[model samples]
Target: MNNNNRVFLVDDDTDFRESMQWLLTSAGYDVVSASSATEFMEIYQGEQGCLLLDVRMPGINGLALQQLLQEKNVQLPIILISGHGDIPMAVNAIKAGD
Candidate 1:
């Protein structure tokens, strides 16, 4: 299958990741999920896609991952999701474009 337009999901919650995978799949998106940023990095091969990332995780949190991606010049678009995020976090995410 073509790699373009695939959706890369990175989150620590199994249930949330599965649910989002199901939802995105049901909507006809090609979905690839990983339990963490490290796992995602292992599987990703510079494919053209958008990322659905969790903001708070055990290691290499969303912001840190975003910075890492920036440093590597990865061009995939990222959407940061957080259930417990506050105003400051949201502001920071917006400013960081993640």
Candidate 2:
């Protein structure tokens, strides 16, 4: 994929967030990490490019966040990552709605 302008990442896992933040930043992609859906939304508003969203989180999950994005008419490309337990939900989320 082309080098995007930015990547908004939201996950409650601090270690994972930090690691991925480091990796993406080192790769020269402007990266922002969020610990919850609210944080993601805040960052999303400021982002100029794509997004990387985690499926499970406290205070509103990725699926719900995706819905919120749609309702807000956000057109950014979003990549979703989820644990095994969230697989079915994630699949449904990817297929079923906006």
Candidate 3:
């Protein structure tokens, strides 16, 4: 793992997000988290890192967020996580080149 590696975690679950932040930090990764896509966009500035997104977030879902990032020419790698019923959506997002 790169020492300067960072992760942008976007999820609606506060507990999950906090837990992930702690786990990533303990693993030597710089982690930044947001409760919604809107919040993430407010803070993201084309930083060099990967995006860990929850597919079912409120106020702009993960796929939509990926599209917005693409529109803005932000090419960071994205990892989408979803519940069982949301797997199709996640697959579609990946198939769409997110």
Candidate 4:
């Protein structure tokens, strides 16, 4: 893998976030995480990589953040993970070009 390989992980669940951090790090990808969409937006700098987002967060949620990123012209690939009831929202996000 390239040294620039990175994954931006945004989720409200601490356990899940940490777990994913470990997994991704073990897989040799540089991993960065934020506890919420707001936090992620605050720190993101349009770096080239993938975004791993949780669909059901407290403040902005994943889909809304995706839309915001689109508005800002971010073109990074996004992988949205949702719970059982949030599958539809995830699909909609994907359709919206997340």
Candidate 5:
């Protein structure tokens, strides 16, 4: 039942990542998580999936990650959620993902 799209999440917030992982798994979706862009890249494996990510992390924020992924042309569907002030930045994220 899980792994339908193999949801991949990368966020610096450990609590949020764990909570989302639990929720997604309970909903019968295979969810993989990473705390940083580096960690996510380590296991990325060029797989196709849906990605849920935060915008500003310690290193390689979501925008930059979108660039990296675009370079590889991995074709991953990404959803970016940022804080209050990051909304404008998140708009850029949408363009980058495109």
Candidate 6:
């Protein structure tokens, strides 16, 4: 499979992550999953693709991980997913991209 076709899925919810992985795989996307931002960081090796990130993980939240990725200049695009999200959080996520 092409490296660019991979999807890095980072979420604390085991069920959600696995479900997404299964769905994406069924859709023919190469999916890589981790339970937390910390685990994602530990396993990620500069792969080129999108990041499907959960917004409320334990160790590092999605926003924090996005910031860390920015600091490290890792250019993977992020799609934030939150079961409970507010307007401020949405605003912050948008602003962070700037």
In the range 32-66, model 6's lDDT, one tens digit per residue, is 99998889999999989999999998988999999
Using all chains and alpha carbons, the TM-scores for the candidates as numbered come to 0.93, 0.82, 0.88, 0.90, 0.88, 0.95
Please tell me which predicted candidate would have the highest lDDT against the true structure.
6
* Global fold similarity of model 5 (TM-score): 0.88
Q: List residue ranges in candidate 1 displaced over 4 A.
A: 2-4
Off by over 4 Å in 5: 1-3, 85-87
lDDT of 1 at 48: 94
Estimate the TM-score for candidate 1.
0.93
lDDT digits (tens) for residues 1-98 of candidate 3: 56258899999999989998999899988998999999999999878889999988788998899898889889888988876546567568878563
Show the colliding residue pairs in model 1: none
lDDT of 4 by residue, 14-81 (tens): 99899999999999899989999999989998788999999889999888998998998899799888
Q: Is candidate 1 or candidate 6 better by TM-score?
A: 6
Q: Relative to the true structure, how large is the alpha-carbon lDDT of every model?
A: 0.92, 0.78, 0.86, 0.88, 0.84, 0.93
Q: In candidate 2, which residue ranges exceed 4 Å CA deviation?
A: 1-3, 85-87, 96-98
Q: Give the TM-score ranking, best first.
A: 6, 1, 4, 3, 5, 2
Clashing residue pair totals per candidate (backbone < 3 A): 0, 0, 0, 0, 1, 0
Q: Cα deviation in Å at residue 27, candidate 2? A: 1.5
Q: What tens-digit string does per-residue lDDT give for candidate 2 at 19-44?
A: 98999889888887889988766655
Model 3 segments more than 4 A misplaced = 1-4, 85-87
TM-score: model 2 vs. ground truth: 0.82
Output candidate 1 Cα RMSD: 1.4
Residue-level lDDT tens digits of model 1 in 8-77: 9999999989999999999989999999999999999999989999999999999899988988999989
Q: What is the descending lDDT order?
A: 6, 1, 4, 3, 5, 2
